[model samples]
Target: MPVLISGSVAYDRIMDFPGKFVDHILPDKIHKLNVSFGLEKLSVNFGGTAGNIAYSLSLLGEQPYVVSQVGTDFSSYRKWMKRQGIHTDTIRVVKTDVCPTAHIITDLDDNQIAGFHFGAMKYSAIQATVVKHKVQKLVKTKGAIGLLAAGNLDDLLQLAKLYTLKKVRYIVDPGQQLVWLTAQHLRTALAGADTLIVNDYEMDLVLKKIATTLPKLTARIPRIIVTRGSKGAYWYYGKKRLTMPVAKPKRVLDPTGAGDAYRAGVIMGMLDNWDPALTGRVAALCATYAIEQYGTQRHAFSRQQFKQRFYQTFKQQVSL
Candidate 1:
């Protein structure tokens, strides 16, 4: 089944800080604070919510379509996606602008600070709407799944509306954009979603913004997945809550794109209708692989290797 992934496509300039973030700044001086850290390592890689998730889905044997807008410098990323067998026909090219770029710095303790330039991502809504016919056709594809990840807020809402009208199952992932999305916008984006995925911090923000508790939110959202970094994730459906533990990794090189990988795993499980607990474990294991690699799309694993690791880590066998 093809997955329609809508979000930003960017170049991630990732760097590593040698020390912990907390060691540098004082809480009392937090207001009007100015600080800089000397980076120990830096590397630029292909990333963005859509690209990262689609890359992992490709590894899982899904030819997902990336619905996004890229800048003139997208040739390299286009080649990379072709190599991974990902579909880019829906990705609009903005000839006048440069691609979106994110400068992410991670500390030794895994805390991160990022500076993002919207660049061509700002035109996402325009591009998406202009290609409505193609998008609608894909939405009607048999067994196709839709993922509205973080990107231009307008584009996210637009895609949500289309998905609902087409009666396609979709997941809403309001990540960094949570800070900018208004209550009404959030409601619109999640109105008809099958699942809502966010980190623990973003979960709290959502509840606060909507002035609703978890129990109340789940009554309407059907399912919700709250990822807690090292603590794993919590899956809430109806009145039941499942706590999932992390899949231990051999080494934690970087945690930049782990969440996107987890989302891909969730989509895989959803496509197969796997049990929630099992799906979460698969998602956790997928995230572990991201942390083991330096960049989001750098990890590679065959189905056999993934299955072997699945058994080794969780002591359970999985077909994929």
Candidate 2:
């Protein structure tokens, strides 16, 4: 069975600002502020929640099928995906549009700012037609085991509903897309999920929006893994709770797509039937590698190397 991933596929345009942003802007003149900072350099990288997760999963020896959309300019990115061994049969191409792009600028102090152009991603609502086709096909053929990552709120929710009706199990990850959803939609997404993954800030918002405690939410969802950057992660398995400590990397370079890497580990762990501690620890190690690279998909590894890192960090052999 293919592990299905439903999310966005975007290009990341990164820029470097040689100086601090605080030097040019005055807080006192906040109401009427207009300033420009010349960037020292610009680099483009492949990313997006689905792409990043699939990249990490491929490295983990599981090439998940990506249910996403790209644009007319996706030729290069399609080639890149092929080179990385990612299965793209389910990706829809909007031939008249350009792929969505994330514009990001980071100062010397590591402070960053970002702007997003939805482009093809804005038409994510149109993805339902394709998803319906794919889902029907999957049901007729192999069973569906999937990941509902960040994407169009309606699209994600509808797919979740469809999968539920079909008795297909999937993981729900709201990522930053949680802001685009409503309390009702949020609750719908959480119901019947095999696991729910979100960062701390997202988790707080979800909890507040739903008017429920973490324990209560976990009672329905089976598992909730809340990730904290440097502190690592927290896992709530039904009524039981577990803490996952940070796994040290050789070095830290960028924070982009670390969450996606962790989700990939979670998917692998769920498939392997590993315990929550082992799952989160393996996820932490995966995230450590993500932070060591400038681009989300640039990090590379093999099972041997991952097992070695796992043992080095936890002092336990990776029997899973």
TM-score leader: 1
Cand. 2 Cα-lDDT: 0.82
C-alpha lDDT of residue 302 in model 2: 85
lDDT of each: 0.91, 0.82
lDDT tens digits, residue span 1-320, model 2: 67888888989887878899888779999799998889988779998888999999888888687878788888888888877778887787887788878888888777778888777776664355765586568755455577888875666887787677777778899887888788889878866687888889999999999899987888888788888889888888788878899888788777877889999888888778777778888888889899898878889988898898899888977753
lDDT of 1 by residue, 1-320 (tens): 66899999999999999999899999999997999899999999999999999999888888898988899999999999999999888888889998999999999888999999999998864355556667778878888789999897777998899888888889999889899999999999988999999999899999999889999999998899999999999899989999998999999999999999999999999899999978999899899999999999889899889999999998998887
lDDT over C-alpha atoms for residue 308 of model 1: 93
Tell me how many clashing residue pairs each candidate has.
Answer: 0, 0
The residue pairs in collision within model 1 are none
Candidate 1 regions with alpha-carbon error over 4 angstroms: 125-130
Residue 246 lDDT (model 2): 86
